[model samples]
Target chain A: MPGVLVIAEVADGKVLPVAFELLGAARALSAEGAGPVSALVPGQAHAQELIARGADVVYVAPESLAGQMYDAWLPAVDAALQQSGADIVLLGQTASLGRDLGPALAFAHRTAIAPEVTALKLENGRLRVTRPCYGGNARAEHTFAGQLQIASAKPKTFDALEPDASRTGEVKTIDAVGQSRITVLSVEKVESEGVRLEDADVVVAGGRGLGDPSAFAMLEELAKLLRGAVGASRAACDLGWYPPSSQVGLTGKTVSPTLYIAVAISGASQHMAGMSGSKNIVAINKDPEANMVKAAKYAVIDDYRKVLPAFIEEVRKLKAQG
Target chain B: MNIIVCVKQIPDPETPASSFRVDEAAKKVVPAQGIPPVVNPYDPQATEAALRLKEAAGGGKVTVISLGPESARDAIKHALAMGADEGILLNDPGFEGIDNFQTAVALAKAIEKVGQYDLILMGRAAADWDMGVVPMGVATLLGIPCVSIAKAIERVDGKVRVTRVLDDGFQTVEAPLPAVVSVSNEFGEPRYPQLRQIMLAAKKTVQVWNAADLGLSADQLGEANRWLKLEALYVPKVESKVEIIEADSPEEKARILAQKLRADKLI
Candidate 1:
C-alpha cells in the first residue's frame, strides 16, 4: 500500500509539538482509505511517542543528524522516503526547517510541494492540498502530477491525537551521509520572557486600533497573567509599536493558539490568515461590525481600554480562586 | 561585487478583504478594480538588501530582474528607483501561467545570461503565491547553496553572512560567494525613492528579453512543464457566529465573559 510519510521535527534535543501535529494530520488523511501513516525522526529518543500518536512505523536516523539544519536532515529524509516508498510526504511548515527544506526536496525529487497548507484530502486517489493564495484572500487547491507528492502544513492546523501508551509500532534505523557544504559558525537566540507565540495556548494580540504603543504593556500584563504570549498586528509593528518579531500576519509569523484574544484589531485578511486557525477567538473592539468582531466567537463591543483592566481583574480573581 | 535581485509584480496585497474575489471556473483571483499592481511587498526589501551590500562594498553593480507581463516593468523600475544600476525584464508570451519550478528554470537561465554576479537575492516569497520556492530552486539549478528568510545580510571575509529569523529566535549562517539568499520583511522598511531618483529611473532603458533570448524553448517555459496542477480555486466559506456580550458595565461584562469561558472549558 502507498503510505504517507511525515518528517518529525526535533529541536534542542526534544521533539517539537508540530511533529505530533503532522502525524495527527497524516493519520486523519490516511483514515479515509489512503494508507498507513509513518514518521521519520532524526533520532530514536521520540520514536515511542510518535507510535502512540498513530504512526504505524517510525524511521529514526543516526544521532549525529539530530540538529535542525536542512543539510543534516535531508539525507536521512531522502533515505526514509525511498525505503518507505510513500507516495505522500507531510512536513510541518516551520520557520527554521520546513520553509527551506520543502522547496529543496521538491527540486531534488522533481516534484511539486504545497507550502503553508491549511487542509488536505484525497479525491479520486490523488492528494489535494488547500493553501491560501493572494495573501489569504482566496484558497487554492493544488495537486501533483508527478509520482511523489510533498507538502507542508501550517502548525496548529490539525489537532494532535491523544497519546495511548498501550500502542506500539516498528522502529527502524536509517543511514545518513552527514555531508553538507555550508558551515554553521555560531547561533544567537533572543530569549523571550513568556511562551513562544506558536506554542502558546493563549495569545493576546494588539493592532493599530490600540492607539498607542504603550498599550501593548497592558496586553503583556494580561498575557503574563494568563501565562501566554503577546502578539501584534502588522499595522502595529509598522507603526514601530512593537518588535517585528512579535508581529503576527501573513508577511510575519503564522500563529495558531487555542485562544486568540484580539485587542483593538480590525481583522484584516493578512492578519486573519495568520491566526484564524485559533480554536477560539475573542475580540475587544469598539466597532461591532469590524471584521475581527464578526469572525470572533465572542466579542465585547467596547474600547479595549475600558475592557482590558476589568477582564484582567476577573481572570486574576478566577486564578486566585483556584 | 555584482548582485542580481529578483522582483515580481503582484496585485496590491493590502486591498481590503471585502473587495477580494475569485474566478472559480478559471481557478484564479479576480484582480480587484482600481487597485494598481505593486511590487511584491518583500521584493523592495530584497532590493534594499542588495543596495545596502553594494553601498557597503563602496563600489559594485546591482541589477534587478523580473519575470512577468509588460506591466511588470514597473517592478523593475521601482528597484532602479531604489538605486539599482540596471534592470532586466524577462517578458515573453510563452512565460505566462508557468509554475514556480519552470519560473526558477527561466530565472536561472537569465542569471547565466547576465554572466557575472557574486550574489543573487529575492524576496522570501511573492505576496501573491506565497510559495517561496524560486530562490532555492534557482540555487539548485545553478549548483549553489541557498540561505532563506534572512532578515540581515552582510559580506564577511568574501562570504555572505546572514542572520536568519527562526520560530523561536535567530541564527547566523555563512555561505560562499555566488550564493542565493531570500530576504524577509524583517530587514526593515525599504528606502523611499526621491523624486529625482524616480525621474532618472523612468529615463533608464530597461532591457526586455524573451524566452528565446534566454535560450529556453516555448515547451519548457509554461504550464506544460509545471509540476503542480491547480485542481480548484475558490473563496473559502467563512462562517462565524459571534456572541456579543452585553452588560450594563465593563466590570459586569468582564465577569460574565470569564464565567462563560470557564463554563465552556476554554480558559
Candidate 2:
C-alpha cells in the first residue's frame, strides 16, 4: 500500500510545531485507506516526537544534512519518498525552506504541488487540495494527475495531536546526498524584538490608515502589552512604515492566530487572504464600511489613533487586575 | 548583463469584495466590470529589480516578458514605461488556461529562444493564483539555481547576492550568475512611469511570440498538459456577524470591547 510521507522540519535543533501539524494533516488523509504514515527529518533530534504524533515510520537524514541548503536536503527527501513508496507527500509551509523545496522537488519528480494548502482529503484514490486564490477572495480546489501527490500545508491550519507516550515506531537513519550549487558566503540574522509573528497567538496588525510610519510604535506598545506580536499590512510595509518580515497578506505571510487585531486596515482582499483564518478578528477603522470591519467579529468605528491608546490602557489594567 | 523579467496581468487586487465573482463552470474569476486589469502588483517590483540591476551593471538590457491575452501587452508596456529596454509577449490561443508548471515550461522555452541572458526575475507570486511556483519551475527547467522571496538583491562580485525574507527574520544568500530570483513586495516601491516615458513606450513595438515560435507543440502546452486540474473555484461564504461596539466615547468603547473580549475569552 502506498503510504503518506511527511517531511518533519527542524529549526534551531528543535522540530517546528508545524511538523506535528503536518503529521496531523497527513494522519487524517491516511485514515481513508491511504496507508501508514511515514515521516522524514533531516536530523535525529526530532524523530521520536514525530513517532508520537502519528508517523508509523521515521527516517532520519544524516546530522550533516541539518542546516543544509534545499539542494542538499532534496535528495535525502527524494530517497525517503522512494524508499517509503509513499504516493502522497506533505510538508509544512516554511518561509524560506519549504517554499523553495516543494516546487523544486515537485519539478524534479515531475509531479504537481499545491502550495499553502489549507485543506486536503483523499477522494476516490485522488488527493484533493484546497488553497486560496485571487488573493484569498476565493478558494480553488485542485487535484493532481501525476502518480505522486504533494502539498505544503499552511501552519496553524490544523491542530497537532497530543503526543502518545506509549506509541512506538521504527526509526532509521539515512545518508544525505547532493551538494548545493549556491554558496552562502554569510548569513546575517536580523534580531527581532518580540514574539515571532507566525508563532504568536495574537497579532496586532497596522495599515496605511495609521497616518504615518511612526504610528506603528503605538501598535507595538499594544502588542507588547498583550504579549503578542506586531504585524503590518502590505500597504504599511510598502510605505516603509514597517519591515517586510512583519507583513501579513497574500504576497507576505499567511497567519492564523487565535486573535487578530486590525488597526486602520482597509482589509484589501490581498491582506484578508493572510489573516482571514484567524479565530477572532477585531477591526478598528473610522470607516464603518471598510472591508476589515465587514469581515471582523467586532468593530470599533472610530479613529484608531483615538481608540488605540484607550484600548491599550484598558488591556493593561485588565492584566494588572489579574 | 542581460535580464529577463516576467510580468503578468491580473485583475486589480483592490476590487471590492462584493464585486468579485467567479464563474464556477469555467473555473475562473470573472473580471470585475469597469475595473481594468492591472499588472500583478509584484511584477512591477520584479521589473524594478531588473532595471536597477541593468543600471548598476553600467550597460545591459532589461526585457519584460508576459504570457497572457493581448491585453497583457499593457503589463509589458507598463514595464517598458518604467524604463525596461524591451518587451516580449507570448500570446497564443494554445497557451490559454495553462497551469503554473506548463506556464513555466513555456516561459523557459521563451527564454531559450531569446538566447543569452545573465539573469531571470519574477514576482514572488501572482496576486491572482498566488501559487509562487513558476519561477522555481522555470529555473528547474532551465537548469539554474533559484532564490525566492528576495527583499533585496544586488550583483556583488559578479554573483547575485540576495537578502531573502523569512518568517522570523532575514538571511543573505549568494548564487552564481544566470540565476533566477523572485522579488518580493518588500523590495521597495517600484517607480512610477513619467508621461514622456509612457509616450515613448507607446511607440516601442512589443515582440509577439507563439507556441510555434518557442518550438512547442500543441500537445506540449495549455490545460491538457497541465499537471494539476482545477476541481473548483468559488468564493468562500463569509458569514461574519460583526457586533459594533457603540459607546458615547472612545474610552467607553475600549472598555466595552475589553469586557466583550474577556467574556468571549479572546484575550
TM-score of each: 0.96, 0.94
Candidate 1: give the clashing pairs.
Answer: none
Chain A alone, TM-score for each of the models?
A: 0.94, 0.95
**Alpha-carbon interface RMSD for all candidates, in angstroms:** 1.5, 1.9
RMSD of 2: 2.1
Model 2: how far residue B204 lies from native, Å: 2.7
Q: Candidate 2: which pairs clash?
A: none
Candidate 2 recovers what fraction of true contacts?
0.79
- The residue-by-residue lDDT of candidate 1 on A205-315, one tens digit each, is 999999999999999999998889999999999999998878888877778887899999999988989999888999999999899998999999887888899999888
Residue-level lDDT tens digits of model 2 in A242-319 = 987788987677788989999999998889878888999999999998989989999999988788888888888888
**Residue B126 lDDT (model 1):** 94
